[model samples]
Target: MPDRAPQPVDRQLPTDEARDLIALVRDIVQREIAPRAAEEEEAGLFPREVFRLLSGSGLLALPYASEHGGGDQPYEVYLQVLEELAAARLTVGLGVSVHSLSCHALAGYGTKEQRAEHLPAMLGGGLLGAYCLSEPASGSDAASLRTKAVRDGDDWVLTGTKAWITHGPVADFLTVLARTGGEGARGITAFLVPGDAPGLSAAVPEKKMGMKGSPTAQLHFDGVRVPDSRRIGDEGQGFAIALSALDSGRLGIAACAVGVAQAALDQAVAYATDRTQFGRPIADFQGLRFMLADMATRIEAGRSLYLTAARLRDQGKPFSRQAAMAKLFCTDAAMGVTTDAVQVLGGYGYTQDFPVERYMREAKVLQIVEGTNQIQRMVIARHLAGPETR
Candidate 1:
């Protein structure tokens, strides 16, 4: 069968507006996004126009201050929206999360004047963004990134390559973290650079295992001069800014993971009930039923965990550890659930004709992105046992 409408997600929105917003999203997914997802992904096409439509529809900036053209929704509402979108297409869902990550440095750390001047355009002005922190030599050890920013007369000159940047080839802006001081984390600072800046260019995108519709590439920043006014936080503050953004970004990934898992489970259940073996529907078999149960359980648990972390964030509490745990558990659950989904469908699941195989492929990246599962574990351990010995 072709892709079905997005599986209806039972939601507990706090307000009527949130409910309406979700309804709008579901309508968009069914009408505009879902039908083209599989085909476009197969073609490795990025639907840049979809993002513009989302921006025009006020769906692009839901969790920021309303004063800055944001919807001012809480993270609780925002994450649920992500989960819904991700269920339809991982590229669109994860792309929004990354764009939000790209907006983080400015939203959280930029000066009041900066926020006023830029946040409006960024949040809903139909612009897309990318975040730059990792390099060829520094993925987990972000502090070891060699991207350097030099202080010139009232301007900062940036020169270095950032690898694995989402939306790199087509971003409208970038929130970049670069070294300015010594050798470690404290030496870093954040800057917001327009995509049209001189000497900034993106390499060809990577050939990925999945989410091919989302470009992942290396960005070259060679003597890109950004006025001091574009500097987000103080010099020596970029690492902290980046970490803080990741704390929230991880939760975004967690929600997306749950979304993909839910989509896979939906497909599996649909297939199992219709396909028969031993003179009965496969879903009637105890083994198949048990697998479906486990998949649903994990999806539920992942949703609850991510929402709990989002609630903590919305309440102004420190939620870094919970975010890490959500990222770890939800992504692992997605991997396992999707893999099992393929198995439940037997030979049919292994084929490209079905989306379960695609789900399985997409789930692998969630475990690695935002932070690898191992990195997430280390983060949680630090909250429990403190930093490791050098």
Candidate 2:
């Protein structure tokens, strides 16, 4: 049987504007993004034009300030948009999230002049971005990053490589964190470096388990010079800036996890209702029904968790712990739901002929990114009790 398109999610949007925004996004996703997703992903083609379409439609900068060419939507609204995009295609959804993370430092801490000069171009000017915080050496201990930036007469020269960078090869700009002072967290600083800086280059993209259309590569900063004017926040403040971005970025991952799970559940339901066993629809079987029910429940719970975190953020509440919880639970749920989706399809599920296998692979990365689920437990533990003892 030909695959049916996934149904639109029933959403509780806060405002008419938000409702309309989601409608527009769904129209774009269905008309342009969804149909091409499987084929393009199979061919390992990056749909750069899809990102450009999103930028032109004012969807790329939804959570930032309107005065700086952003959509100025609240985090709650913005994250639902991510969920919708992700349900259609994760590359597009997660790419938007990473781009927003790349812009966070400048939008939040850059001088007014810097905002005026760079923010508009970044938010809606069809420019892609990458955030550079991780290195080959420092993944969880981001404080131990070895990338160095030395102050020259008027420019800071950056040296070291950024690993596992999303959009690394294709980004037009990078928000980079590098060490500047003595060892540890307080010594790191953030800078906005043009992607085409003379000494900056990208290594070949990683051969990943899934999401092949999205590039993940190492970026080499070989004494790249960045103007002092492009520095964000104060000196030695990059670590804090990176954390702030991750707190919000975690919510993005959570929403994307829900989307992936939702998509998987949708596929499973569609298949079960159509595929028959013992002279009845398999969905009518109690065991399969229970499995389907559990998948639906988990997806709903994941969506609620991420939205709860986003609302707390929109209300200006401290939501770091909640974000970590959402990231941890939603991603793990996605992994389980997608794996179950494959099981629902029985023999057909494990093949490329079905998307659940792909969803399963894509969902695995959500547990590892933004902060590993293990790290998320530590963050949540610190909030609940106290910092871990040595």
lDDT against the true structure, each candidate: 0.95, 0.93
**Regions more than 4 Å wrong, model 1:** none
Give the alpha carbon lDDT tens digit for every residue of 317-349 in model 2: 999999999999999999999999999999999
RMSD of 2: 1.0
Residues 120-216, candidate 1: write the lDDT tens digits.
9999999999999999999999999999999999999999999999999999999999999999999999999999999999898999999989999
Q: Where in model 2 is the C-alpha error above 4 Å?
A: 1-4
TM-score of each: 0.99, 0.99
Q: Once model 1 is optimally superposed onto the true structure by TM-score, how far is the C-alpha of residue 346 displaced, in angstroms?
A: 1.1
